[model samples]
Target: MSCFEVVDPLFGAYVLGNAPVKQIATGFDWVEGPVWFGDAGCLLFSDIPNNRILRWSPSAGISIFREPSNFANGNTRDKQGRLLTCEHGTRRVTRTELDGSVTVIADGYGGRRLNSPNDVVVKSDGSIWFSDPHYGIMTDYEGFRAEQELPCHVYRVDPSGEIKAVLTDFAGPNGLAFSPDETRLYVADTGRMFGSDPQHIRVFDVALGGRLSGGEVFCTISPGCADGFRVDSEGNLWSSAADGVHCIAPDGHLMGKILVPELVSNLCFGGRAKHQLFIAATTSIYGITLNRRGAQTP
Candidate 1:
């Protein structure tokens, strides 16, 4: 059977008929983040509940990259090729240097401790942006249960190490990414854990000095919320859904779906040509080659 559900004809041109979804890794307690390292020829993802990060490559299969990872959730590489991670246990965002030393990026704001940094992405301007949600500290399963010190907000860390809360209106600001040209920003609001709030993604027009305007609902995910997503070169948003992955056009319309047996949490494009979509589902990691390329910064 076909693994794709086409909603719009444009999606048909982005998918390949022979490229099937392949489960490359499994046996995790809840995978959340998946980042591709083309230079290293490997993919790294977080097993949130397991408190570890695993690396997978075609030649080496699966290997433990970091243990006791402090319940890391989302990850992305900076312009310098260093790893930026959101740690639930520490409730901070950290950067892994080329020499393997970890640097704390942000832990608090306005003299209060941050709830927990969930997902992260770095811009081409050397600034780091991430979502701060309370999901990490709500339960002992994913992280240590603790009091929330600050309101959930999305943050931007300038290249000079100045941390600023770019957006503060979200109840649960989860996964986020920038458009190919960095002119727009897309963020997902999953709502409070188990709350009745709507689950949808929002888009903002990023202006000079990182000013944002035009906060509007871009699209809403069905069957599941938008946990994480990535934009392609053509500005198509591929978001994680309960049933599978949903492809949303720039016009806020569903284009297609990539069906997976597991609930997808996050995904990123990898491979030598940036055509492979590596997915982080509930307990497994899957990958599939696509006809399009990811627009994320390396």
Candidate 2:
């Protein structure tokens, strides 16, 4: 079967090839958090079960970026291009400095430890946002199992070192991303991982000081959950699915699906122009060049 499924006529415009899902690397125990570093000309992502982070590029191929990554799950670059990571084992969020040092960003709240930071994004104002779920603490393969100290919620950490629980109505919040203009925030509820709940994405209005409002259902994925995704410059959400990558329009319409051979775990836009879409599926990494640029495009 063909790898591309163009539901809407416009969907074909974004896909550059009939079978563009090329396997760039393999031999992983479940890959996630594919983020591009244009300045470095490589892509960095997590191997959750392996407890390491891997780097891939045309020149260098695949190599160990960090072993014992604290069972890192998600990653994104700050405004200054520093790496922001969500560590499951450590049960905290951290930042990789330019000088090769690690800075602990957020590890706890109210004097109690966080469950496990699943995904993270950095706003233009330097505020850090992430989804906290209990997945990391529920399994020892990805992270050490531990008792839950907090309910699942989304958080925002400001430059002043204050953490605020912005949303608390999810069973298990998984992935999150911001619109290109940063006017909207999109979060996914992968309830299947924790309990029997709908697998859908929610949208919210970004208020002043990075506050969130107007929580509403954005889209629903059938037969699978939205694990991780990224927004394009035009606001389309490219989300991971059981089949592959599903492209949903800003209006919450399912526009297309990139039919990857394996289940897609997460994806990100990278390359020098930030137009290449990288897919981190179950045990391998797939990538393709796209006509669209990511929200973090330089």
Give the range of the ten consecutive residues with the poorest summed lDDT in model 2.
191-200
How well is each residue in 108-226 modelled by candidate 2, as lDDT tens digits? 98899999999999888989999999999997988999999999899999999899999999989899998988999999999735478877899999988987788799998765789
Native-vs-model 1 lDDT?
0.93
lDDT of 1 by residue, 1-298 (tens): 9999999998899999999999999998799889999899999999998999999999999999999899998999998889999999999999999999999999999999988799998877788999999998889999999999999999999999999999999989998989999999999999998688888999999987888998799999999899999999999999999998999999999999999999999999999999999999998999999999999578
Clashes in model 2: which pairs? none
Candidate 2 local Cα displacement, residue 50, angstroms: 0.8
* Structure candidate 1, residue pairs in collision: none
lDDT of each: 0.93, 0.90
TM per model?
0.99, 0.97
Poorest lDDT segment (10 consecutive residues) of candidate 1? 206-215
What TM value does model 2 have? 0.97
Relative to the unseen true structure, what is the Cα RMSD of model 2?
1.2
